[model samples]
Target: MSNPTVTAAQANKTPVLVAICLAAIILPLSFVSGSIATPVISRELGGSAQALSWITNAFMLSFGCFLMAAGALADEIGRKKVFIIGVSLFALFSGLIGFSSSLIWIDLMRAAQGVAAAAALAGGSASLAQEFEGRAQMRAFSMLGTSFGVGLAFGPFLAGLLIAHFGWRAVFLSSMVIALLSLSVAVTRLNESKNPNAAGIDWPGTVLFTAMLALLTWGLMEIPSKGTTSVEVLGLLGATVVLLILFVAVERKVRHPMLDLSLFRYARFIGVQALPLSTAFAFVVLLVLLPMQFIGITGMNEEQAGLMMMALSLPMLIIPMFAALLTHWISAGLVCTLGLVISAIGLGWLSQAIASQDMFAALAPMALIGIGIGLPWGLMDGLSISVVPKERAGMATGIFSTTRVAGEGIALAIVGAMLAGFVGQGIQQLSLAKDSHTASLAVQRLATGDLHQALLELPSTNALQLTAIYASAFQHLLLWLAAITLISAAIVFAALCLKTVPTEVSETLCEPDQ
Candidate 1:
């Protein structure tokens, strides 16, 4: 016999799930779309490299910093309320981005969109968790992961089409339309839920933590240009440490904490945290680096490079769904471990193929890397809160989301800086550049894929010479990344596979083979 209450709950879940996925598309869409449209934006508005950088950096900064606070707010307030408002604000800011005549105005709007993205993610994910449980919950989060992958998979193509036909403004306006459509669907069907015990925001913790993230991210960004030891970089990083200590001390003493510090005790939780960090090293960094290598070194145009990336991102859309099924046969921990191993293999393969500068030879390795990344992406979110009591789902999502997003920013910065150093060293060995200063300037321009300008910085060098330097330097970088990814996999195994867990986590992580 079917219960009416259960039937109604089941019906409600589908609409809410669709809405969240639709809203999820806006963040990554904005990023890739903006990247494809940057030249168009710059021509009309006029921006120096630093000013243009704020187009994405501002968004990431606000988004990463506010994730935990927004999560706490959703739990303290109502998840449904937060979701609706956040998506609505996202639509509004995205639309505003289209109307801006100045780069600064667009930067401000993008920053606001980031805050909205953080809220929408935290609230929507927690709400989704509340709508389902156990295997059903795992499936729902898999769909969430799929939506994110779908965005990355097609973002460049979609943005290119929109920018070519209707101009760059169409990209943001189209995202706004999706957000509005998502809100309309969710408002009627979504249920309101929150933690009864959740209290007001922890003012001290919120401020300190946000400032800490802002400083840390901004400091990392400074490293590529300013060097690690610059006063600006050193000061910001020093302040970040002080803020972190203060946030921890405040959260411990607060009666109603913004974050529950005790959840860190679980080994599964630690493993879940490591998952995003691993992906950042193995996959996220490549998203940017590959485009540069293809366009700047391999002599592909933007469109061709974007098309080549499809081999890397396309599997993300389906492999995550497959991973969910694989976990039913093996422990999720083992699944992630194997995924990292696969990516390490792909990285090594790519290093070898990349030297040939043949796009076709790179396809298989790129797709392999995508499949490897998708495995953990599919399960990490479900595993995040599953290890904790249901009551703390909001906090769990916040912590995990913050770690994932912030870790990406850090990886990009550190890897970018390291690559510049390697390229500089390679150019010096070539003995074509006039001096160290000329080599440094060439490295800076080449790092950003401004090959024409980079060539200008080295008058004695031809395209072949500069790209050869990059190919050799890039090969070494890929090998280093492969080694790091394998190490991260071992760390993940030590945390999740080495220890025995309770029944809830056991179901989440492990299943006996048939």
Candidate 2:
């Protein structure tokens, strides 16, 4: 006979689970919509290209950097409390950003929004770990992933509709409603959790790590304009390295490290880390880049560009579930590796299709990329902590979330710099403008799809020539992305399936419980 107490406990978890899922939906929806809203925001606010970039960068940077700190704080104090606080602040900041007239105010609020996101994701996911166990836990986390998938799948189209009718501010403001809902649900339904013996956080390490990331990102952002070899860029990069070494030293010595550095010792854990970073470079970067390509370069309107992006994100809704089911039949590592391979193939196909200058032709490859990425994307949250012991799951979840979001932010910046650099080189080679300064201006304008302004700056070039060069640069970038994805697939497969590993490790890594 079933005990009433046990049945009651199980029933109570449902509302808490729903709240966590809602929180999951809020951030990813914000991420995609913010990208979709960027150009429109730029048009209205009239900021310089450098300042305009903060719309995405500021949020990602703060969100990425503070994840570990937030997770640690959650463990020490209370998970549900931190989560509620984070969601509430995110809603407030979204409203502030939406209403602000100045770029500086908007950017500051965006950064604050990111910190809140970090707290919510880290606290909420960790709380999820506490609420469920074993295979049930995996399914619950899968629901979490699906929530993220839902946001990615529908965010663009929704943002487009909102932009078309209510204006771009809706993109930011829309997230407020979601956040408030998630917050209210969490406040009421979720039970607070904490670690009894958890030590204090390593504030010094946290500060250094955040600073290192900020410096590295700033250096990358400067690369397109200042050139990689510029004194300022070099100094920032150097400082970044120094800070990283110091952060490592502090983490090694700290009584309570933000990330348990030794977690990297497990081959499977290392492989799991690669999964998020791979998806970041291969999938997340494209989320930002593809929409810009569709809207800026090809002159598609918001709705049209959002529709084009559907081919890229729509598969996410279904493919991740398919991937989860397939793991029961085959090694999870193999499935993820295969997904990366498919995505690499899609990237190559995309590059080739770009040569045709046909948007519709590119759709199939975009879908292919989405389908491929969905496999790995679905499994990441589960795999992140499965390799580690339950006792360490909070730190594991924190580190994994940090890697995924931070990697996305860093990859986006790097790819942006590379694309701009490629366009700059193409401009000089094509002699689009004789003056170096004029060519630089044209490169900046072209990168943002301000082709009209670019042509005005480079009077010598016609529309056809600039378009061809842009296409060529884009093609090369896609190929590079494809190559990186392929290499990561091999590494992840090798690490996860290593025969030298212990039997228990191998079973967990390759044959996750379905």
Candidate 3:
């Protein structure tokens, strides 16, 4: 009576390749668009740089804050339903953003987009995890990484082309198109995957946690644009600190915490979680800081600088193909640690090349940084989800995304502060140079471009002297970044030693719940 051919494979639903493509379309657009679209939008509306910044920051803050709650919701309500809701909300707000005339409207819509993105993003990884297992799971994770990288790599360049051809409105409109298409596919193709036994949404904890993240992120964003000493800025920072404490207290008392405070009990979970956080921090800081250095100090034009910046994404695109293959034999921890070490080396090498203005020479080190970023980041989702219960994959994925965005925001604040400090030092050194009068003139001219401005400002009689001063000061920034990269390497290495690789534990952890 039994059908011999009815293996799990025969019963399994055919994987929807379109879903991955749909996910790829929406995954990193919000991030790339949020950061990349601001300047054009601000200029068109005659808004301050600060207003442009808030447009991006508002989205990041809300997106990061709600991720955990979205994950919890996905688990309770079903990923298919939650994803549809997120997509619909995302499309509606994205349309609002495209036509908005006011800066306030743009910021609010961006925030709404963030909320929708949080839900969609949280479920994306979980959907893949639930749909596939064993070799299939590995393939799904690898493909998921590729999808994410494609979104990230393409987002800015795509936005640039659209903005140039169609204007800033095109960027938001594109998101809407992708969101609607994805939503349609998901509704028709994806099945419900809700765990009835999973804990319900933790409203109190979610509110407190989101409040804490928002306060902290807002305060961090202020440090760059508004000096740290400003009364209002300091007040925000103080509020963030207090809210964080309260958030922790609330989580401990909550029956179902949005963030499971007890997850830290697993040393492995802590390490896996920390890897994504640090990797995101390092990558974001480098992305923000490096392009300015190339444009300001190395004298690349905007387009040239943007192209050079592609070196970061290049390795990300290629390394994962090899990385996915390696994962079958290599422990995820080893691969991730190797990635971190390689990135540190690349950044360290980049530090040494600061004395040279050649962009070609800079490429090698930067390409290495890209390789480093791709390897670990690619493995992170798999490693994190593999450790948690299958029923809780949505929640875990949500926390992973939250940490990632939070790290990104934190990196922006930290690196922005460091860059300001470096520039200030460069100015001071230029001012204090022996040929002070001529150097001051050149420093003023630095608004044009680093190399040419320095060349122009230095007296023909003292050209060499001034050039040396500029190079010396610029190298200091390089040295500082190099040091930070090494420090990051050490942190990663320590985390690796403290945690076991997932392959060793995957079987035990992946055992289906009774």
Candidate 4:
């Protein structure tokens, strides 16, 4: 016999789920869409390379720094209130970004948009956890994952279409429209949810965490251009270390910590948390690097490159639905481990194929990577939230989300350094055969990632040889990326191997002090 109370709750869940999914879609959409439009923005505004990088870095820095505090606030105040505020602010800032006359204004607005995203993401995930439980919780998280995948998969395609027809501003304008629509749905359908007995915010812990993230991210962003040994880079790294130590000390003493330190005791939780970092390092970094390869190595236009990426993105959209089903038969931990292994294999294959310089040969590896990445996409959020209490959903999701953003930033910096090092070495070797000035100029064009420009600057006879040199350097970089990804998989697998004492989700959600 069906219970009327259970039936009523199920019926109300649908609208709330829709609103949460929309919120999930909006944040990633804003991120990837901006990435696609960045070149056009730089061209139109006449911004320097350093200033242009800030357009994206500013958003990432603030977004990552604010996530922990925002999540705690959602648990303390109300998810509905935070979600609505985030959506509204996101819309306002996104629209303002489109109207900016200078690069500085755009960077400032993008930073504001990041803060708004942290709020919406934390609040939305917590709300969904509060509204559903058990199998229903798994389904809700799967749908949320699907929405996130869709945003990332189609973001480039949509941005290319809009920028080609309506100009780059249209990309931000479109985001504004989506945010507004999500805001309206949220206001109408979402219910206020928070921990009734939640303690006050841990201001000291929050400040220390935010400062540590900001300094760390700023230093990472600067490393590619300034090199690792620069005074500014060393200073930021030193400051970040001090803040991280301070943050740990404060969290231990705080009555209500921004991040509960005891959560790390569970090996299962640690394994689940590592998924975002692995995915970001392996997949998100590729998303940034591959477009450059397509344009610089293959001489593909922006539209063509965006379309080609569909080979990678399409599988991510399709595979997650099956991941849920697979987990029913296979343990979620084993499923995640398999996904990581497959991703490493795919990346390894791609490194070999980069030397071939055949577009068709690249597609198969790209598709394999997409499938491998997608398998874990559906499982990560569900598993992370399941281990913790519903009340702590915001904190868990905040930490998960932070790893992703920070991982991407760190991966880019690491890969950038490798690429620069290898390419410089390749150019130096090539200069022994040709005039040093011409070789250096050709390599400089290659570094810009503009194939057409490199081709135009070099003699036809030399173009093919110079391209081969660049391609060889790129292949080496891919090998390093693949190695790092494989290492991450091994770490996750080892973590999951540890024996863990099972506890009820409800029991886990109780106050840390209790």
Candidate 2, 411-466: lDDT as tens digits: 98898888888889888886668787787778877776667677878887788888
Better of 2 and 4 by lDDT: 2
lDDT of 4: 0.75
lDDT of candidate 2 at residue 484, scale 0 to 100: 96
lDDT of each: 0.80, 0.86, 0.66, 0.75
Better of 1 and 3 by lDDT: 1
lDDT (Cα, tens digit) per residue for candidate 4, span 1-514: 9889988988887888887788788777777776666666755785544565666667777877787778778878998998888888989998999888888899899989999998988888878878899878878887888898888888777877887788889889888888888887888888898888778788998888878877887786665456678899899999999999989998898787878878787666677778888887678767767766775567665667777777878787888887777865666666677787888888888877888777778888888888988888877776676666666655676677777765666666556556756765776765532564554444545653544455555654456776676778778887776777788777766665444535645322111212
lDDT of 3 by residue, 177-242 (tens): 988888777777677798677788888788877777777777766554456687877998788788
Give candidate 4 regions above 4 Å deviation: 1-9, 387-395, 431-466, 498-514
Q: How many backbone clashes does candidate 1 have?
A: 0
Model 3 lDDT at residue 120? 80
Q: Give the TM-score of candidate 2.
A: 0.96
TM-score of 3: 0.81
TM-score sort, best first:
2, 1, 4, 3
How big is the positional error of residue 323 in model 1, measured in Å on the Cα after superposition? 1.4
Which of 2 and 3 is the better model by TM-score?
2
Model 1 lDDT at residue 95 = 90
Candidate 1 structure quality by residue, lDDT tens digits, 1-514: 9889987877768888899999887777777666666655755786554565567667777888788888888988999999998999999998999877889999899889989998998889879878888777777777777789988888777876786678879989999999999999889988899989777788888898888888887787766556777899899999999999998999899897877899887777888889998898888777767866765567665566668888888888888888778876888888988999999999999988877766689899999999898888887877787766776666787788888887776777667777877777787787867876676667776665556667888888888877777777777888889998999898888877775655545445654333
* Steric overlap count per candidate: 0, 0, 0, 1
